[model samples]
Target: MPRRLTRTLRRWLYIGHRWIGIITCLFFAMWFVSGVVMMYVAFPGLSEKERLAALPDMAWEKVRLSPDAAMAAAGAKTFPRDLRLQMLDDEPVYRLTGWDGQRQTISASDGHGIDGVTLDRALAVARHYPGAADVQSIEMVERDQWSVTARYDPFRPLYQIALNDAAGTRLYVSSRTGEIVLDTSATERVWNWLGSIPHWIYPTVLRKDNALWRQVILWLSGICLVVAVSGIWIGILRVRLRRRYSGGRVTPYRGWMAWHHVTGLFAGVFVLTWMFSGWLSVNPGEVFSSRGPSREMLQRYAGHDAPTVAAVVAVTPSSRAVEARFVWLGGAPLMLLANRQGRKLPSIP
Candidate 1:
């Protein structure tokens, strides 16, 4: 009975390995090739340098309202987490951000709140990009393959403008604030089809729903992991390291079968480790969930239970500044200014 049970179990192992290996072989090839492509090109995004370079200098002379008035018009009840004054197209606007991630844009010229950006405004914003050529066409995109990530949620309903420049650059302008949220070149879009898109299993339909995407990755990697383990086990059972085969060979198989058996023995550990690591990437069962700082830990880091910033009445900003930032540091309120070059101007207390 014992010998019969052993033979039955071995047969099942072989069957499991062969079938699962056939199923996951495509995924393995895709991941290996796409991972290499990813090393050269990353997903599309707007860098700080690109954004700053595209912005027109702040026209302080056009400002008829003060920072205090702008904040009040934005309905800010307390000192906001972030406040910045920058140009929106040709007019100056103040962007106020709350601690809970809420944002409001207020016009500095008339102290009125900005409701939404028009198509003409979006086109005007796009023209400011360096080396921008004649406009090819503009399409309204709620969410597409390049802008499917959650980070672009705040800037939904984007205006995708294609420029006729040599680079075939496409710029995404937020319909809410008229800010250029992201830009992608022709080269970036083409390479990413084989790079981050496939490597991350990112498709517009799949990635739009974050929860469903995570589940898909988890299940696919889990099944592939089972294949890796079974392959290693079957390889060990078939390989003969000490005892020679019929022709004094370590593996009884010939041609491709021999190559596979011999290499599987030597490379099994690496393949298993690689497959296991990929499974862990999605943090299955919340095994790798972040243990971020608690309330107590945050207080300890800040050296205080709570730190507050007092709203201060300010004069008109100098003409040299392109942007102004309100921040509280070391329990003191400060106003930092930045020029068009992105250099920090003197801070005012």
Candidate 2:
């Protein structure tokens, strides 16, 4: 390259890195600190242990309708992808999940389908939790900071309830299924404001628009990656390795510039790799594997159609069983049972 062109390019590189670094470094620092906070405090959501602890033991004696009857009420043409009976606010309700990702709740007592949950029903559901005493209904939220992600879309328009306990517990009950889907304590909420909220750039205002959020993340990380690369290049060009500068120092600059040059020389590669990996986290351009299998792909993987409802009803679960999960293996219908202890009983097919 010509001398003038080389100088121009170097000048632009320095200028670009200097300006972009101001913004990206803040984000970089935020990511680093928030990542540490996230090590101990995770974003709030319902875990399996918490869910089980809140559930009242299965009232098998209250179940007057069969699983098949519940499935029929759920409008399942064939066997559902998943079916389980549990207490829904003191009533035995069968929750059915179809292969297409739709969910329905049916009353095992009267075999009536549950279409919507009233505020009274939501409070009842919240009261089932372990520490729920002064349970107060907050407001119906379509999308909020705690439940803004698409994972909660299936349970849209949730009822926010405050337990008013020592933990300052808050519960999000699904208005559609009448189930407590998420619970967060005051501690979790306060910590996550510094943890996942900033790390993932997941403010409710931004994250609610999934496409815009993804684009913003990709652009921000992409620009930061450029800054990292340019900064490394500039650092390499300025440092003297073979023939040392004044005072036998590898870096001629003094003060903060000297410190920056020395540290960048040692940590530049790691910083570059880190930024590159962070940029790749968004999986730009569908380069990595796409999302989970589509509906058609799932159907193909099933290999066979749903099991006949007759076959499903024919098998009887154990007397001690509180929950039953039905699935097909080797094109054969299988029924897996779980007792009150959450221990699996022998499969009955």
Candidate 3:
């Protein structure tokens, strides 16, 4: 390259580096601080432990209807992807999930359809919560800052119930499933404001639409990735082992420029990795392996056979359980019980 052209290129590179560095460095600092908060208290979701704890144990005595009858009521031609017995306002009910992701709840007493949660039913659900206080207020949640992720899409129009607790506990009960989908205590809510919400740009208006939120985060991280890489390169280019024109110096720049250069030199790898990992979180190109279950795995677990209503009715309760699942153990049928406290156990029968 000619000397004049090289000079012009260097000048523009410096300008781009300065402005982009200012913005990207701000993000880098926020990411570092917020990442530590997330390390302990993650954004709230319905974890398995939490779900089990909230469940009302299986009322084996109340199960009068059969699984076959429940399937018939659902009009399912194939074996359901998932089928389990749960208590819906004290009565035994079957929550059947289909391979196509359709969910149907049928009365275990008489095999009638349960459309969704009513206001009274919502209140009842709240009253049954484990650490619940008197229900303060209940509102139908279409979408909100906390429940905007795609995972919550299936539970749209969830019932948000506020509890009169010191932690400002809130429960998101699915209207269709009538199950608690997300639980946020006051501590979790407060910490996430500094943690996940800002780091992921997770405001309701932007996050409600899953695709849009993903793109926004991916591109912003990509920009920061660029800035960090370029900064590392420039820091290297300007580094001097022996003094060029000053008292023994490794960095050519002076003052804030020198501090930015020195600090970035040591922390550049961290900054770069953080931005890259955040970009990977969106799985920009499917570089990482898939998360959770696959369709084939789900089908395999479901198998071809299903439990009959006779067996369901035959189960004698060992203890009060919130839900029960029929499973085959060593060729014999058994009922898996989820106690009110979330313990999983085999039925006495």
- The top-ranked prediction according to lDDT is 2
Comparing 1 with 3 on TM-score, the higher-scoring candidate is 3
Report the alpha-carbon TM-score of model 3 versus the true structure.
0.90
lDDT of 2 at 79: 65
**lDDT values, one for every candidate:** 0.80, 0.81, 0.78
Q: Using alpha carbons, what is the TM-score of model 1? A: 0.87
Q: After superposition, how far is residue 85 of candidate 3 from its true place, in Å?
A: 0.6
Q: Write the per-residue lDDT of candidate 2 for residues 73-100, one digit (tens) a residue.
A: 7778866667777788788888988877
Q: Report how far residue 30 has shifted in candidate 3, in Å.
A: 1.8
Worst 10 contiguous positions by lDDT, candidate 2: 309-318
- Per residue, candidate 3 scores C-alpha lDDT tens digits across 141-163 of 89887888777777778889997
How many clashing residue pairs are found in candidate 3? 8
Query: What ranges in model 1 sit over 4 Å off?
Result: 64-68, 77-79, 290-321, 339-346
Q: Which ten residues in a row have the lowest lDDT in candidate 3?
A: 304-313
Ranking of all candidate structures by their lDDT, best first:
2, 1, 3
